[model samples]
Target: NKVSGSNAYVKSCRRDGVTRWSDGNTVSGCDGGEAFVCNSQMPWAINDQLAYGFAAASIPGLTEQQRCCACYKLDFTSGPVVGKSIIVQVVNSGPDVNPNQFDLQIPGGGVGIRNACSSQWNAPSDGWGQRYGGVSSRQDCYSLPAAIRDGCLFRFDWFKGADNPTMVYSKVTCPAELVARTECSRSD
Candidate 1:
C-alpha cells in the first residue's frame, strides 16, 4: 500500500486523441492509449534540451489503489537520447501500456522544448526501435528546437516506492547505472 504513489490526485488529462502535443503541458488520467515515440537530431549540438511528451492510461486495476506516479529517471536507451537523462511525469493512467501524452517538465536543460505537435505516429526504430518506422500523424519531432534533436529517443521509468528497500519493480531494470537511473523524494 505504501509504494508512495503521489498524494496528488490522478485525473484524466484532456483527450486530444493523438492530438496532444506541446511543452510544459499538464496531463493526467488519460485513458487514451497513444504512445511516446523516439525522436532525434544529430549529436554534437551544444544546446541539447528537448521536452519530449507522453501520456498513459493506468492499468485499470492498479489505478484505484495507486495514488500517484513519479517519473524518477529516464534513459535514452534507443535513439539519440541514449546515455542521457531527463525529467517527466505520468500524465495519465490508461486502458493499457501506451500513454495519451506527456508533459515534459524540463526545458532547455536536457531535451529542450518540444512544441505542440501530434502524438500519432509510428514507434521509434532507432533508440529501442519500434513496431513501425518514424511515421507520425503529428508534426515532425525534428522541427523542434536544436536541443531535442541532439538526444531524441528515450524510455522513461515511472515508479513509486517499494514496500521494502531491498525489493524492486519486476519490469524496471534491476540496478542503477545498468539501465535506468533512479531518484527519490528524499533526494528532492
Candidate 2:
C-alpha cells in the first residue's frame, strides 16, 4: 500500500480549542470538532478522535492530500530516530510553518518531548514535552488509534466540492517489513 509523496521535516505540536471571535483553549478533545476549523464560514468540523496521532497544519501543496485527516508515513533519515517510520494524521494547518514541513503531535509522534500540549489534553502521565525545533524525516503511513479502533462512527455530509472526501485519508497499516526493521513504536 505504498503511495508516492514528497519528503518533509516533522515537528511536534498541540491541539487547541478555538472560537470565531477569540482563540479559545481546551485541554481535552476538540469541543465538537469545529475547534480545528480555520474559517468560521465553513460548515464542516474535524472530528478529533485521533488527536494523538494527527498532524498539525503545514503549507499547502507539499502533498496532494496534506489537508485534514491526510495520513503520511514519516521515515526518519537521521538522529536516534533513523530507521524508524511512523504514520501521522493531519489535523491542523499553520501559516508560519514552511512547505515540506509537517508539525507532528508532540510526544504522540514519538519524536520530541510533549509540552506544547496540556495535561488535560493528550500529554502522557509521565509529563515530558518536546523542546526540539524539528525532527528529520523522509517521505511515506496507517492504523487508527484506540478511539477510532473502538468503533467510532462518522457521517460526512457531502457538498459539491467534496467529490473525493473519503479518499483524502490513507487508512493502510505500516508495512510489516518497515515495522520489523525497527524497535520504535508509535507513542500515544
Candidate 3:
C-alpha cells in the first residue's frame, strides 16, 4: 500500500511476547485493562540520517497478525526530518489508524487513543501533554517518566522535532537490534 504522513507516537509496552490488541484491551504487564507502550520499543538513532524503531500500523491487505514484527523502511519526504530514514517494526495496531498509515512508537510523541502511562509511570492523566500530540519542546519532556525521558529527548535532538512527516515505505528485513527488542521475527 502507498503510505504517507505516517505519524509517530508512544503507547507504552506491556511485555515482550504479548501481542498488542487494537481494541485497547488489557494485555500482560498492564493493569486495569490498559495497554502500555514499552520503553524498549522507543525509537533510537543509528546515526544522524538513520534510525530504528517500532510502530502500530494498518497496512492494507494485511491482517494484524501479519503486520506484527514486520519491518518497513520509511523514506521521509517532508519537515525537518526530510531526507532521513527510519526502519520501524510493527509491534502493535491502532483501531484509529487508516489504511497504509503507521503510528511510530516514539517516547514523548504523545499517547494517542489508549493511555496506560498514568498507571504505568504515574504520568499525568493525558500523558506529558495533549493525548494526541504530546510535549511541544525538549524541556517539556521532563514531565515524562525518567525511564523514558531520553527517548522523549530523541524527538528534539535526533529527530529535530519533526511533526508527522510524510513518507514512502517498503518492507525490509528486520534489524537484529529491533528483533532483539521485540523478540519477534517474521517468517515470511
Which of the numbered candidates is closest to the native, going by highest TM-score?
A: 3
Q: What is the C-alpha lDDT of each candidate?
A: 0.28, 0.31, 0.76
**In candidate 2, what are the lDDT values of residues 1-188, reduced to their tens digit?**
11123122122112332232122342212333323322111122222222123345564455433344345655545444344344555544543445656654432223233332233244343322223432112110012233221111121111111111121223344333322222112321
Once superposed on the true structure, which residue ranges of model 3 sit more than 4 Å away at CA?
1-35
lDDT of 3 by residue, 1-188 (tens): 11122222223345331344333334533346445555677889999999998888999998886777789999999999999999999877877788988888777778787776777777677778888889999999887767788888988988899988899999999898987776567767
Runs in model 2 with CA error above 4 Å?
1-52, 59-66, 107-188
Better of 2 and 3 by lDDT: 3
Stretches > 4 Å off in candidate 1: 1-5, 10-54, 57-67, 98-188
Steric overlap count per candidate: 32, 12, 7
- Could you tell me which 10 consecutive residues in candidate 1 have the lowest summed lDDT? 160-169
**Prediction 1 TM-score vs. true:** 0.30
Deviation of model 3 at 92, angstroms: 0.6
Which number leads on lDDT? 3
Name the lDDT value of residue 117 in candidate 3.
71
- What ranking emerges by TM-score with the best candidate at the front? 3, 2, 1
